[model samples]
Target chain A: MVREQEFLYASGRIRALETKLLSRTIVERILEAQDMDAVMRVLSETDYAPDFEELESIYDFEKALENSMKRTLGVIKESLKDQRVVRFFTLKYDYHNLKVVLKSRILGVEVPENLTTLGEVPVEELLKLSKGEKDVAVPKLMRLAFERAAEVYEETLDPQQVDLILDRALYEELNLLVQDIGHDFLKSYLAALVDLTNIKTMVRLKYMESDLRTLKKSLLPGGSIDLEFFEKMFQEPVPVLIEALAASNYSKVVKDGLENWVSSGSPAVYEKLVDDFLLGMLRKGLYKPFGLETVVGYLGARENELKILRVLMVGKINGISEDMIRERLRDVYA
Target chain B: MEVTLGQVLALLGAAMAVFLPGIGSAKGVGMVGEAAAGVVTEDPSKFSQTLILQALPGTQGIYGLLTGFVVMQRIGILGGNLLPLTTYQGLLVFAACLPIAIVGLLSAIAQARAAAAGVGIVAKRPEELAKGITYAAMVETYAVLALLASILMLFGLKLA
Candidate 1:
């Protein structure tokens, strides 16, 4: 109880900050803009004004967006009393950087300098860990995953193995962190993420015409949908798998993604569905007065808004149609 | 003047009536301050509005002190005479104080939660601050009822 009360100030600040987040109407206005310059104009009206104003070229919107995300995360990190929960939000970025570094090492390509700074671990440290220094400040879980992924890639000489191993490790470590905090909402959120990832992996592997062995290797642990159920899914058709999961919580997402894949031969709709579902789960935090929920919810919302802006900006720059951009836009948390 | 066991029990009751609810109000008001400060930090314009919400939980402490004052007066402590009483009468006075001491402590905490939540409303919808105040003010009813109960019981006690 005392611990929950400690979040009172942070949660309230997040509530005020929530008002400043990009709303659906603003996104619609951005989409309605006729050209890239017009989209920039719309974005300039937001908290991104400073970044947008400083953009030397319209194409450099990606850098501006990155700056916006970094600033948002930095503010959230400062307000939070418990760094562990906030770190959970950024842990994915660390794994993302880790994946890029490991893959580039295996391919003998130059490590990209544009690595994200959003991770809990610094990119410089991640780069050092990639050099097999072993003494860097990376979390033990990630360091071990890094070594394991390196060893596995050397044996198989396959790049995909690195992603699977690292992805699994990310979730496993997230599970452990949430367990340590002892928050049931976070535990179940992680479970839902695992379940959705497994479902997405299954659908993608099925589309690739991969064998059952690869499918078995890709499924993650700790989701409510166990390995036995996924193994059963491997034998059945996509629709049958959807029906099998009908009684579970993910039936709608599974059905939407699978049906879209079956009809359009693409997993795009499924990816959107998964994001919307997770946001829906986090939306429960909006009503909570104090606790981890409000902080996590605001963080999730900010990340989602950043994602929406990225899609909009990329679409505008690439000259993709407004309707196409709208189709790809995920639900906003506000 | 010599202090009796009955007077000691009654004094304990008066102290509880003041301190217990005072502690509760302190906690409640402090919690609301933290939350209200968060809103004010983002937009200083909402200070007066959030401050109203912060004060909502403060009534319980006043009710507690008022009850304690009434008890002191009835016992002649305020009159400088110091009424002598049987042990049973002191217990009766002790029992009267419980209504405000217990209820004031609980209601203040509960109201603080409501008021802290109201800070969120003010943060998001400044126009709806009234509704937030209304919700937190609903909790004040119980504290008022508890104060009335304690006051009525003290006045009804036939200590003489």
Candidate 2:
């Protein structure tokens, strides 16, 4: 395709860079590293980063990791021929910051420390918009979500509604952006992500034995499993609903998770498996070689790598067991 | 008016041999340059290695120029005189140029993609630059063969 040719160089560079991604063996070694010092030593071997030599504590390492993530995002944005794709990926962070701001405002406190500063909107502007100040500088979608979330929080005096409002608004805006982009592959990827997110919500609510109305309210529409379609599936029991997912790409994950959930009754494994399934969806982008897929896929890979490292490091700091830390690790990109 | 149709044909053959492959090589080299620039922007240490890969796609232009030069000399155009070529001989010359003209254009561009990809390999792993060059060189074989075929045909052309 002409699109493929357009991205030939960027994709080629990414392919080479991907070869240097942390291998599963290396990640395993890092996880098996006995102490934080040992872990940081193994991390120093990889590009886990260049400036983390001063990282003595988990907080220090997080800051370093956050900086690297910001740099990587900027690099990937610069490399890609399409900035729209990056903008679309950035929407999630804006929404995430929006949520943090709302929570901070609700608590009548300053915006929490280490709230991710990875979005298009600055923390200052997002906080302004979250406080229901009329700031035209804030993005329209972000402002809309913040105002709506704050209004609902005021009405119900429930923090839950704020999350529901923002999440729904996030997906609604993301799906619209995806449509505007008009790339079928991305559309499919985002659709699959939406489906996974909806499943995550359903599983969480189902395990909590929350009311069906709450579950219905939490459900994000516009996935392949539309809200209209899911309304029929909603009335079914959690196990049966999970069984329905067996027909989807998450068949193995849902089935295996369902088997485990029966004994544990906890959706933890199910949630992990589903998160992995989402990454698996992103993994298939490697086959495309040239497109928005490689750029977006590498971002996903980098994000997953960061997440695993954080999990491993935090688990170490908290004196958690190896198996517990390993259980939470996402699949490695390499 | 003094130039015969045969002379025009022979000149066209020379032009085709030079222009098509030159354009192909230019495009190929430019593409590789863009890729190499990106790598160099990230890591300046890879400049020498990427420069080598960037030069790979440029050989087709030389082959094209050589073919064009030989054709022009054969017709005495470069020598400042026009040969009185028959229509058949003109067609033969035109046919001879086709191998390099077509293949050189295509192979150069293909080689450019390979060379650019090689620059990527060099960017990430400088030690693997040779392997990347080998990949780019694979696309060079067809261009060489095409040049050989064109040269052989041109030399073997019987002027009547």
Candidate 3:
């Protein structure tokens, strides 16, 4: 199929789904729901209920919501059957599965069966791969990642390095795929990914006081930050770092965040600021002529909603008050 | 007969006008896609909100293209040549492409970063994504204005 035709079909399906996203009023009503069943009912009334019957409990309801979303997304992926978009989604799962497996193996922690299988690759296979027992193509495919991560492990044994390597490798692979496809939406999406990753890395390094070399090594090279500027920023004191960021495109947001961090002396504010900055960008970037944008955007929104739901659920289970939950809630954009 | 420097510059300007914004938008939107995928994997239901988030970075390319089309018309590349071929004319065309090209390049990428983070927001708080998108789009206004100014300049050149 022609790329344009695939995009048209995908966009059409996305439009249908987009129509069903909850409005402020609907979200408010859901928030006011007295119980899980009421919330489920609210969800069912909307377009999100296709797989609702599969739920067996409140937890099941959440799981089913996630699963249904995956199913729907899978359907959307089918629209791009001729393209590598499906592989893109599958790679995400692969990344997640690899992370879970590696973390479990390195920490000598037992892997939860449910947690293991949630991403692209099946949990069992991931477990085997983690144990160095699997000779499947995945290991070969991830050869670069394995080698890089091994080097990090040998050097510092910092599990974070493993994460950093995986993230960098996955992004590199994803970047190549996006470039090959050359769609406007996909390009923007990948760029955002790089930017966010950089922000996250910068924030973590800042908090940890890790040197520029370590931080630089951890970054995915193709991001917005140039190596020279990144090094300069890293060498500067925290105050200087904040000032440098404040002078750039991220100035206003980062400045405000820095002020808050200074006043509160809390790193959480910075983390939240990073979150806010990236979220704000994604919301505006997807409206133009790209079917992939819509699909990808919907996927993002769904994830945010789930995170909020999970927070709310945990609060409910713990008997936390709504007001407390409200206070604890990070700015949605943040 | 040889192509004058003036003619070469005009062509270069027009080409940049067309291609630069396209590059910017492509980069911007690609940035957001990564975040969107991550969000959807965690929760598929927030798709609509994430779509809006991802769309924020795409405007730079549109603005760039609009400017290019207008410049083409002004240069008589599309129709009539109202302006005489002067070094100044070439310079103006070159100048006109600069703001959109440079801003389009930088802001589009910046917005893409914002979109990636926006995806995270959607994943964690889908209902609040509109505000996030608005914030991301704010940066593109300057690029749009720059493109508009270039088009206006072309119109003025035609009148002159």
Candidate 4:
């Protein structure tokens, strides 16, 4: 009872912050805008207005988006009593930067793009760690995962192995983090994320006509659905997999995602459905009066909003048709 | 001036009436204040609106203090002549304080949660502040009833 009340301030702040989230209508308006300038105009009217004002150029949308993400996350971090909740949201970025740094080191190439500062570990520290410098303290889990992924890539000579190893390690760290936090809601959320990703991988590999060995290696552990279930479903056709999934919680997601995949010959719709499903799960925090749920849910919503903005901006820059961009658009939390 | 067992019990009753609900109200009001501060941090214009929600939980403490004040008066702690309460009468007074003391403690916390939720409403929909207050006020009804029961019991005691 006492601990739950600790979140009252964060819950109230998130509730207010929720009003600033872009609605589906606003996303559509951004989409309908004739040019990038019109998109900027649409965004300028929202909370992103302040972010845009500091931009060096109208095209520096990445800086604006990253600044906004960093600021929103900072707000959440400051308000949260349990910093582990922040780790739950941010651990991914650390793993992401690790992947970029380690892979570039392995390939002997210049780091391709900018490392996100959103990770719990700073980019500068991660870069130093990649250079085999031990001066900076990094999380033991990430350091071990990075070394292991590098070793696996060296042995297998497969870049895919790097991703699989790091991805598994990422989930492992998330699993440990949530366990330490000790919330059933967070544990279930982690399970769902793992389960959904495993399912997506299984479907994609099936389409690739990959061997069972490849599928076995790529599937992540700690999901509610065991490996045996994926192996069993892997042999059967897509329809049978759909039939099997109907009895599980992901029945609607699989059914809709698979049908779209079958019709469109693309996984874009499935990806979108997966995001929407996760957001829907996070939004369950809304029903809870006060707790970590609202805080985590708010973070998830902010991330989703950033993703939508990224897609819109990327599409506009590339001169993709609005309809094409709309096809790939995921649901907004607002 | 040795304190009699009866006087001790009567004093215990008055202390419980003041402190238990007072603790509850402090917790309740603090919770609402935290939530209200969150809203005000985002939009300072909502400060007055959220303050109203913060005040809702505070009534439980006041109700408790009122019950204590009446008990003090009845026992002559306020009137300057401590009543020579019988042990049975002291027990009765102690029993009377229970309704407000226990209820005030629990109801104030409950009302604070409702009022904190009202802060969320004020954050998003400032126009519906009344509805938020109404929900919080609903929790106040139980606290009010408990206060009334304690007051009535204190007044009905024939301590003369």
Candidate 1: TM-score?
Answer: 0.96
The CAPRI class of candidate 2 is acceptable
> What is candidate 4's CAPRI-style docking category based on DockQ?
medium
* Alpha carbon lDDT at A150, candidate 4: 82
lDDT of 1 by residue, B1-160 (tens): 7788888888889989999899999999999998888778788999999999999889999999999999899999998988997788899999999999999999999999999999999999999999999999999999999999999999999987
TM-score of chain A of 2: 0.92
Models ranked on TM-score: 1, 4, 2, 3
lDDT of candidate 4 over B56-143, digit per residue (tens): 8888889889999999999998978898888988999999999999999999999999888888888888999999999999998999
Better of 1 and 3 by DockQ: 1
**Chain A only: TM-score per candidate:** 0.95, 0.92, 0.79, 0.94
Residues B1-160 of candidate 3: C-alpha lDDT, one tens digit per residue: 4445665676688788768878888866765664565446445776777777677778888887777777767666677453445777787778877878778878887777666655655554567778678778788778777777777776676323
Best by DockQ: 1
lDDT of 2 at B68: 94
Candidate 3 residue-wise lDDT at A296: 59
Q: For model 2, how does the per-residue alpha-carbon lDDT over A1-334 read when each residue is reduced to its tens digit?
A: 2265566556656766676678898888977888877877887888765747756655677888787788878877777666777887788888888888888889988746547867877888876675566745787877877888888899899998988999999888988888887878778888887777777777667667787789888998678886765666666766787677777777788788766776887766777787687778788666553556777787888888888878877888888998988887888865
For model 4, residues A7-86, the per-residue Cα lDDT tens digits are 88888788889899999989999899898789888988999999988998867788888889899988877886768888
Compute the interface RMSD for each candidate structure: 0.7, 3.1, 10.2, 0.9
Question: What DockQ would you assign to candidate 1?
Answer: 0.85
Candidate 3 docks with a DockQ of: 0.03
Report the Cα lDDT for residue B79, model 2: 75
Which pairs of residues collide in model 1? none
**Which regions of candidate 4 fall more than 4 Å away from where they truly are?**
A56-60, A110-112
